[model samples]
Target: MDEQQCWEIIEAARDDAGQAWDHLDERLEHTLTRHLVKLSPPEVARFAEFFRALQHRVNREDLFMAAFLIHHGCDDDGFGDFRAGLVGLGRDWYTRALQDPDVLAEHPAVRARADISALMLAGFRYAPERALEELTGEEYDGYYDSGEPVRLDDPPPQAAPVPRRLEKLAALFPRQQAYLRELYPQLTE
Candidate 1:
């Protein structure tokens, strides 16, 4: 998809918020996947590199807040956190952020807004599978398109504790709990 088309889809999804998947008639997922497939190898590599770097910066506190915000569908504030945390972090900081996200958390505002939990959740949701598909030039057999019973591999153990805040939110919102379980099955265990 062209930049304009991409932005249009993104805007539409943002407008729909948590229900973007259903509101966009499911075209959003396919469009995104198609766009990913269109990217060159180097571009895809860079994308994967960025996620790995960002993942490295995330701390336990950040993860807790992220999961809380995402489970509650707090997109506006979440977007703010992402922009403020990453916008000015140059290429070098990207490398450093992976080692010590503390630098990104230096500004209290940035720390307050950047939801590393949500970022981590999103990364787990899409990045790895996309990267694998992009690099291998083969589609995963998982039913991403059909929304059927997609096969899931065993999830890695979670090192961090599931915060009480997130536990309460999950209890209140079963859908979010289900979503979280889909991404991090260990949460259920």
Candidate 2:
């Protein structure tokens, strides 16, 4: 499948899940897995490849800062899930986020400080791989080689004091840093 088709599948699953974030993980997994089951193994693999590529696109320091600000804090794995969450937002938002992660400040979930576990579930779900396993009765081996790089932009800076970190983050993403300051007063205090 092509990139647009891959996004269509994700968008379909998102639409199928509707407005509620409850059980979004399970609903999305079910919808994506069901859709993948209809495709041939190669097509399923292709879809996974596209997903990986898209994930790579958002694997940047500035976007990671956005995730960290939105979620309060994000570690290595949390960043992975954050990228998946960004993808789950669908193509246009994803594209805009790729260009400027501060746009994420507009999202309701980020604003409400709601349970965002479902948004982060895509990285953990591994739906395409799971579908491949179910289809072939074998584990999915389609993954980037060990040599493949994950970051598409600069790496995050070394750890430092919260205020100092905020300065750097504010420099990189002023809007997101401002959002974080407003949402979590204790952090700024």
Candidate 3:
């Protein structure tokens, strides 16, 4: 019914208590909580309808985002990394995310996805392992590896490399132009 009540269901679901299952407001928080705890097939089915109703025109996304920040703000490491990221999300993140085709492919909730991802990245930058408060010149050597699943303050990807000269070279043409890509199974789409 309310945020507090919804939160209880979330925490209960996270722990798999199954006691507060009824309290969850058709919101799928309970289902998501279950998914986070242990993803099951049936729960996955429920998420379709749930998220459809749950994430619409940024309103629900904002609510869900706020709740997530409240519930999981502290990422066990006792750092406010996530909080800082969410609050500090800027235009650059939004702009970069817009350029990503896969990001644009996420229809209906495109804006929400962009917002969430930007926040997540910025927050990860503040994480305990290697916070990129201010990157050094050496650290900015075309690559800023935070050494984690998330990138810290690395700038967005540059223009894809153009194989001009390599493509023109008859000898190197076959070897350079999409050669390794075709050769390696993983490299090919």
Q: Which candidate gets the maximum lDDT versus the true structure?
A: 2
The lDDT for every candidate, in the order shown, is: 0.39, 0.68, 0.28
Off by over 4 Å in 1: 1-29, 65-124, 131-189
lDDT for each residue of candidate 2 in 39-80, tens digit (9 for 90 to 100): 887777777777787876777766766777766567888888
Q: Is candidate 2 or candidate 3 better by TM-score?
A: 2
Candidate 1's displacement at residue 81, Å, is 17
Which ranges in model 2 have alpha carbons more than 4 Å from their true place?
Answer: 123-125, 141-189
Best by TM-score: 2
Residue-level lDDT for 183 in candidate 3: 35
What TM-score fits each model? Answer: 0.32, 0.73, 0.18
Which pairs clash inside model 2?
A: none
Please give, for residues 4-61, the per-residue lDDT of candidate 1 as tens digits.
Answer: 3323433443343342222222333344445555656555444434433333344344
Scored by lDDT, model 3 comes in at: 0.28
> Cα deviation of 126 in candidate 1 (Å)?
3.0
* Clashing pairs for predicted structure model 1, backbone only: none
Q: If the candidates were sorted by their lDDT against the true structure, best first, what order would they fall in?
A: 2, 1, 3
Q: Regarding lDDT, does 1 or 2 come out ahead?
A: 2
